[model samples]
Target: MSKRGKVWLGVAGLVINDEGEWLVVKKSYSGLKGKWSLPAGFVDEGETIDEAVIREIKEETGIDCQVKGLIGFRTGIIRDEISDNMAIFLATPRINQPFVKSERELLACEWRTPKSLVTDHLTSAMLKEMASSTPHETQFCVNETVDPGDIFGYTSYKLFF
Candidate 1:
């Protein structure tokens, strides 16, 4: 099929500590303002999914992380904006350190145990989906408009929704 706009492939990482805390961030973007989700972002050209996941974690949280495995994936279509496929990885930090929200687009980075994760706002669908997945295997999910054509209109930064 001839694709009109763009297919954005992104990555997110579930960086865990020995304490079993998972890394998460609040986006500062106008659309995602105050939304809590995994440390994730777009995959730059020529970047591997693994590399993108690690880089996103570092860039957003200021903590170095190593991709442990492909833990999950989530695809979403922002109608007439972009079609997104996000890879979620299991990761570990290179050094014992705290997360510093480095990017101006990041509001905060924190270690939240599963019990500590809140659902009052827009949290990652992957988080809920992850509960049903075994860490030993990969989990995948598809969300957004079912009509593919309506969503593949143009490259977008609408990943926040």
Candidate 2:
């Protein structure tokens, strides 16, 4: 029998500003190193995936955002035994503020036109695909927040449909 490792949960956002520009960030490490991709990161303990994505965007770009809906998910075996599942969300900035890039986790944070990202060789295929789809064009899963304290006596609960 094959021993399996724990599955890691991750989140990313297809954040588009009111002007219709997509948010892209360049990380300092991982497969995304030096590549402009959607703002993404691993989910920390005690936080929901939606919260994680919102935090990631804030940390990486200094922009506050709200998740519009669950857009999609990707799941795959990352290594011999470990696996990864990432949820993608369609989001929009809540405030019209300039982005301040994180010097610690990112090399660059910029807003680019979807067409520009699609044509930029520096943009990864995954990012290009994300940028190609707009919030209005893509279908999103319904996201509903529930109070777990009332149901399971937990802190938080979220339902994605």
State every prediction's TM-score relative to the real structure: 0.74, 0.78
Runs of candidate 1 with Cα error greater than 4 angstroms are: 1-5, 118-122, 131-161
Error of 1 at 93 (Å): 0.7
RMSD in Å for all candidates: 5.9, 10.7
Q: Give lDDT for model 2.
A: 0.75
Tens digit per residue, CA lDDT, model 2, 1-161: 13323666889998988888889998887667787888998888799999999999998999999999887765544334556667988899998998888998898899889899978877865666556655455454433332212311223223232
At residue 53, candidate 1 shows an lDDT of 89
Q: Lowest-lDDT window of 10 residues in candidate 1?
A: 152-161
**Per-candidate clashes, comma-separated:** 0, 0
List candidate 2 stretches off by more than 4 Å. 1-5, 133-161
